[model samples]
Target: MVMVEVRQRLVVGISGASGVIYGIRALQRLSELGIETHLIMSRAAKITLAHETDLKVAAVEAMADVVYSPDDIGAAVSSGSFATMGLLVAPCSIRTLSEIATGVTSSLLPRAADVALKERRTVVLMVREAPLHAGHLKSMLAANDMGAIIAPPVPAFYTRPASVDDIVDHSVGRALDLFGLRIDIPRWRE
Candidate 1:
């Protein structure tokens, strides 16, 4: 008998933040790398997509290998035992950050993040809010204390990105770097 190994899987969460494009780019890059993606989007994320991008919700969902409803707490990715490389909440909203920090997940997106943290797996949150107040800073600090990586999608000017796509791709590529998966992107040189 022959045994086949399971492909590497990643959990992608999109929250109601202004940078929906970041999540979209992540899915595209992950697909290019041949990794299985399990996606979950908060209700607010769908609305944000409609407002910010031309892509429809169904189009985004189709990019993932699997999709789960925000309210589906019993979804496979919600469990630590599901065996994902990590969870990346691109454009993570402040509300989602607070929920993960306090371990009070009300939706699959945050719950998957919590599960990743509890398992000591990588949980990268690309928090999108600017003009951070003390409360937001504290929440980020709390999440960091619990083993989550607070990776805001700050673009690397060193790359000299020429377009908005370039900037978004650079940020998404850098976040995926945390998982040790190297995708094709411009890198800084000494």
Candidate 2:
């Protein structure tokens, strides 16, 4: 039951990739900006959260304005009528990326992205895998061809990041830029 009825809304999906913090920071920043967030976190993402961060699942869930079960295909976000700015799959796993690319979405994460794509909304996938193979590259290409931005969270050296958090913020900010939700972080200067 989403109640607030905020103006700007976004669908954020977290996969079982390495950098769950990308999604976490996105949630925090989005909340700070008063954008209503609809979160769909994979079960694998819950397990990875335990291994990656000390924060509990409930804490992460609390960051979003609304949370949806990944298995609930009937959720509002699974349809284009939900009226979100778009879907942001942070730390997008290869499996999730492949599913979205092939249009074979079985769960709500990629399903929301599919809906966004079909609705002509911005869909930004922060793919987190390293050492990509032909299949992975092809999937990225296909996703890009389908209007999804395959934005890997590559750190910006020009920002002169002092820590891991800084790198993450810069990358997340850049990704949010694709959605026209600009977070005020260090940017490249002339």
Candidate 3:
């Protein structure tokens, strides 16, 4: 059982959203916890990381045990037999959300997420859009119904973070908790 838990794999998907650091932080925490990581970043996400964050694609990709090309739909992650615990779409773009919600598996990210949902594993989407319209909300509801946890990157004032990394870590930590990871971070008490 210990080996089973230790072998638990996490799939991290980076989308073309503003908060690329959240995905990177999640990968760092997963590495520290001895969890195997499989990473997939959309082409647009690669460009967004360069424009919005200082970290290079190779640097971020290094955190994962395996990295899949976003264009490769036949990647291991896209198959249920790959046996990942689930996929976490940090900074999940609205575009990606719509694709996954509607069963569009053109890329490895959505295909992997689809496999996760079918396998009844946790699929957490750290949605990063604001001022959502009706269509966006509808898409989110569809995804939710399909067993994906819709996690928006909303700040938690209760954490009282002093720096941007703190805020990012808090959100990433909470996301990890969904997978039963006891990451060491401040939590609100009753």
Computed on alpha carbons, the lDDT of every model, listed in order, comes to 0.94, 0.94, 0.91
Give Cα distance to truth, residue 32, candidate 2, Å: 1.0
Clashes of 1: 0
For model 1, how does the per-residue alpha-carbon lDDT over 1-190 read when each residue is reduced to its tens digit?
Answer: 9987999999999999999999999999999999999999899999999999999999999999999999999999888778999899999999999999999988898899999999999999999999999999999999999999999999899999999999999899999999998988899783
Q: Which candidate has the highest TM-score of all?
A: 1
Instruction: Give the TM-scores of the predictions, in the order they appear.
Output: 0.97, 0.96, 0.95
Ranking by lDDT: 1, 2, 3
Ranking by TM-score: 1, 2, 3
lDDT (Cα, tens digit) per residue for candidate 2, span 1-190: 8787559999999999999999999999899888999999999999999999999999999999999999999999988777989999998999999999999879999899899999999999999999999999999999999999999999989889999999999999998999887888997773
- Candidate 3: give the clashing pairs: none
Model 2 TM-score, all chains together: 0.96
Q: What are the per-residue Cα lDDT tens digits for candidate 3 across 51-155?
A: 997889999998899999999988988888888889999989999999999999988899999999999999999999999999999999999999999999778
RMSD in angstroms, all models? 1.4, 2.9, 2.2
Worst 10 residues of 2 by lDDT: 181-190
How many residue pairs clash in all the candidates, one count each?
A: 0, 0, 0
**Candidate 1's error at 117, in angstroms?**
0.5
